[model samples]
Each structure stands twice: as C-alpha cells, then as structure tokens.
Target: MSPYHHGDLRRAILTAALDVIATDGPSALSLRDLARRAGVSHAAPAHHFRDRTGLLTAIAAEGHGLLAEELAGTTDLRDAGARYVRFARQHPAHFQVMFTPNLLHTDDLELTTARALSGAALTDALAPTAPTGDDPHARYARLAVWSLAHGFATLLLGHNLDRLLGDEDPEEVLRELPMFLLPPA
Candidate 1:
C-alpha cells in the first residue's frame, strides 16, 4: 500500500474498516487490510484502534449512537421500528458488528454508554403505547417490540425475506407489522 498522510487518520481507518466489513463481512476484516485500504502504514490502524476487537468496539459504539439518534427523533413506536430497520439498511456494516457482542469489548465504556442510550430511546418510543402500572407487562412489551424490529431487520439484511417481501419495501412492512399484533380499533 502506498503510504499517505490523512488529516483524520482515525476516521479514515474507521471508514476503510467499515467498507471492508460491508464488502466481505467482519470475519475478513484485518488491520493490515484496513491500513492498505486507507493508504497508510500497517501500524496506522493499530495506533487508532489498538486491535481488531477495539476497532469493532468503536464501530459498535458508533452504531448504537446512530441508532439512538434515529430512534430519539420519533415518539411513535411504529415509526421508531421503521427507523430501526432503515438504520440497519443504511449502516449494514455497523449493524452487523453492533449486535454481535462476541466480537466487541462488551465492557468498553463507550460501547456500554452508547448501547444504554439506544435502549433508552427504544424504551421511550414504547412509552406512548405501553400499558400503565404493570412493570412486568411493560418490560415484556418492550422486549417484544425490540425483538420484532430487530428480527425483521436481521432477516431483511440477510435477504431471508426475499420470498415473503418480493418487491415490497421492508421499512414499510415493519411500519405495518403492528397491525398484525393488535386487534382492530
């Protein structure tokens, strides 16, 4: 790889890493490959991320933060769910790494905090539709909502929904998914 100077080496390395993950899956990501993609020395990525796990941790943290921002924009649970799917579509690399905690430093403070913020945004989105006073049911409802959205996104990303969805937009499908769970008003 031709050595080059990047005004923002950290961001450049992260961007290159994400591209690699997106194109080849995280299993194929290597610091040396990222450095080459970034047109920097092999040691350049190590200086920014320390190791592969550290790089994945940064991606996970950034993914959660982006998801939090997306979810926080809307109070409607359905809208939030749609946004979740959209975020996955927009940042498949980050989405892939974010959910696979085994690839990350789970105790990393940045990852933990970003994850908590995303969880809070999801919970807040559920607040409008959540039943009153029953914490157990509320908790269950939150899990259900999260599972539905997350499952749908995962399936869509993996192209597992091709037969079922055909030409339909996945985000639109997710926005309409709640209708199947609730009876007519």
Candidate 2:
C-alpha cells in the first residue's frame, strides 16, 4: 500500500472494521484483518487505534454521535424511542460495539463524551413525559423509557424478536409498544 494512503487510513480502517463486524460479528474483528481490508500496512491500524479496544472505542463513539443526532429535537418519547431503534438497525455493527463496554476502552475521553451527549439527548427528550417529583412513577417512567428502547434495539439486532414479531417490521412494533405502556400526555 502507498504511504500516501495514511491520509485516509483512519476512515478506511473504520469502514472496513464495520463491514467485518456486520458480516461476521464483532468476535471476528482483527486489526490485521482491518489493515488488510484497508490496503494498508499491518501496523497502520495500530497507529490509529492502539489496539482492538481502541478501535472499538472509536466505533462506539461514532455510534453515540449518530444516536444523539437521531434523538435530538424530538418532541415525543415514542418518536425518540423509534429513532433509537432506527439508529440501531441502520448501524448494527456500531450498535453492537457501542453497548458492549467490555470490548471498548470505556475510560476513553472521546467515547465518554459521545456517550454523555447521547444520554443528555435522551434525558431531554424524555423530560416532557417524565412526571415531576420523587414519586415512583417518575423513576419508573425514566427507567422504562430507557429499558424499552434499549431492550427492543438489542432484541431487534440479535433477531431474538423475529419469532415474536412474525412478518411485522420491528420498528413499527417498537413504536406501538410504548404507546400502550406509557400514559398519554
């Protein structure tokens, strides 16, 4: 590979890594394989990502950024929840790594910042529906919103809900579920 490829190596490595993860799952990912796919020297990926944890951490950070965009400026909880599922479906590889903290450098500053941004967006989006005060209802609503969105995203990504969902689109099912579970405002 040309040394000139270094200018684009970071993006190339991330794209290749995402492809590998999407095709064979995260366990199959290797810096050597990513370097090969990116047509760079084996050491090139390491230059950008010190190791696999570093690489996964970068991917997770990107995932959170995308998630924040999806959840931003939402006026409804169901809308935000649906956007969360959409983000997961659209970027399954990133989604998988984003939630699996053990596979990433959780202490990485960029990853932590991205995660906090996404969390803040979700909190803001849910604030309208969340009841005020220290009541169990407020706590339950907050927990339920996160659990329902994350659980559905996890299930959809794993195909664990296929038998339960039948021919229906999973996103549609998710959008409808919160409506029934949460009190309408």
Candidate 3:
C-alpha cells in the first residue's frame, strides 16, 4: 500500500480509527487494520500516533474535548446534563472510549490537555449546583449530579434498564427522570 503524505495521513488515520472504533468496539481497533482502511501503508499511523495506545489516547482526548464543549454550551445546568446524555447517544463510540480510563495514555501531553478541558467544563457546570455549605456538602452535590447523569447513560447504553423495563422508549423514561430533579412546587 502507498504511504499517505504526512500532511493528511494523520487525520485520515484518526478518522478511519473513529469509524472502526464505532463499528467494531475499542478492543478490536488495530492500527494495522486502521491504516489498511485509511489506504495508507501500515506504518503511516505510527508516524502520528506512535502505537495503538497512542492512537486510542488521541481518540479519547478528542472525545473528551468534544463532550466538554458540548456540555459547556448549555443554557441551563440541567440542559448540560441533557447534552451529556445526548452526546453519548449520538456518539456511542467516542463516549465509550472517553470514559474508559485504562485505554487512555496518562502520559500523553495531548491527552492531558483534553482531560483538563473536560474537567474544567464539568466543574463549571457543577458550580451552580454546588452545595452552599461545607466541603462534604459540595462533594455530595457534585457526586449526586455526576452519578445521576452517568448512571442513566450507562444503563441506557447497556440496555440493562431497557430490558428490565421491557422496551417502552428509553428516552421517554429518561426525560421524566429530570422532573424528579426539579424542585417540587
């Protein structure tokens, strides 16, 4: 196979990588396979990603940044949670890798940068609901919000709850969960 020019090879590999991850799951992602799909020589991805972990790390980083920006754009804090849910639903591949820490290369500079952006965005979104009292209260608020959103998404993605509830439009049930989060009249 021909090697791609350096300029576009990296992007092309990453794009192909995302597609592969989406359709085949992270465990099946192989740079050699990705390069084949990208139409570059097998070694081309190494020039950009160094190795399989490097490529996955980059994908994880990009996923984090995308989720961070999407969550940060919400007009309401509640909406931020909705956006998080929606992003996972829409980009299941990206969302899956973004949260799976073992797949991320902690030493990678770009990965660190992306993780920080994601952390900052989440912290900012949680700021409004932060407990008005001591550290414990603040911790609880943050944990509560995160757990609520994350648990919902995890259940929805894995079809655990859907199976339990027996397939009555999961989103509709999720939409109603937010109402419980609302302050009662």
Candidate 4:
C-alpha cells in the first residue's frame, strides 16, 4: 500500500474539493489544486479518484446521502420539501454537482445507490398524498413538489429573488411556502 494512503486521504481530498467548490464553484475544481490544499502529492488525489469525474461522482454521491438524511427527518412532505431547499442552501457546492449528470459518473454504483436513497426518501414523504394504482397524478404530484422546491432553491442560490425578498430571511420565506403552495390540511 502507498504510504500516502495512510490516514483519511480520500476524505481529506473530498473535503478540499468541497471547500474549493464552495469558494470558487464547480468549474474551478482541479485535482492538483485540491491535492496542494490537502497537503498530499499531486498524484495522490488521482490515485484515489482516478480523475475529476470520479471525484465529482463521489461528491455527488455524498451529497445525495446527506440529502437523504435531511429528507428522512420530516414525516410530512411539506416539511421534507422545506428541508430539501435548506439542504441546497446549506451545501451549494454539493447541490450543484449532485444534479448535473454530465459532470458525474452516472453509472457508478455508489452514486446511483445514494441518488436512489434520496429519491426514495422524497417519494416516501409524498406517498400519503400520492394517488395509488394507474393514475398519472401521483407521478405529477411528485414532479410538482420537486419542481417547486428546486426552482425556489435555484432562484435563491442565484440571488434572482432578492428584490422580491428585500429584508426577509430566505429560510423564513421558505418556511411560509407550504402555507401558500400546499393543499389545506
């Protein structure tokens, strides 16, 4: 075994990648730069990740796992939806990479498994409102819920709604979303 593999090299590389992305966005990611920040040899990150795609796939997978944990905490779809938005805001770098399939190794087992776990958590939260059997409304309901949260998060991330939001906290605004968007309980 390579002596460079000694302590948590993979985790350190991944953490450095996330810090770089959080500061400079995904396009700024470079294994050499990350390795330097991680205090590892330039080849060390490559040894663990193979390439940028491999590293990004791991990041995206980890993002999905975190998202699953966030969504799983809420019993109600509305709260789950709010947590979805919060997760995006809290982990913008991960959020950006997780949804961009072209940037990830889409066929990787870890990525797909993590993605599925996140999807299942969201689906399960919405299951109570989802119509059973051959109805397409259930699928549409899921789409609508996801769309609402994603669109809101995207807009917030881009600061596109700052004029509309003015002085109010974004999280507070998001918490009010269910009052207007969700069906009466």
User: Evaluated with TM-score, which candidate comes out highest?
Assistant: 1
Instruction: State candidate 2's TM-score.
Output: 0.90
- Write one digit per residue (lDDT tens) for candidate 3, span 100-174: 878878878888888888777766776665655458877676667667777887777877776666856554455
Q: Which ten residues in a row have the lowest lDDT in candidate 3?
A: 176-185
* 2 against 3, candidate with superior lDDT: 2
Reference-based TM-score of each model: 0.92, 0.90, 0.84, 0.91
Model 2 C-alpha RMSD vs. true structure (Å) is 2.1
Pairs that clash in candidate 1 = none
* Candidate 4 local lDDT, 50-92, one digit each (tens): 8999999999999999999999857666677778889998999
* TM-score between candidate 3 and the true structure: 0.84
State the lDDT at 166 in candidate 1: 92
Candidate 1 per-residue lDDT, tens place, 32-55, comes to 888877888988788779799999
Ranked by lDDT, top first: 1, 2, 4, 3
Q: How well is each residue in 1-185 modelled by candidate 2, as lDDT tens digits?
A: 76446668999989998998998988999999888777778888887899988999999999999999989998688778888899999999999999898998999999999999998898787788787667888778767888899998998888898899999977677767735545553
Looking at candidate 1, the ten consecutive residues that score lowest on lDDT are: 176-185
Clashes of 1: 0
Off by over 4 Å in 3: 132-134, 163-175, 178-185
lDDT of each: 0.87, 0.86, 0.75, 0.85
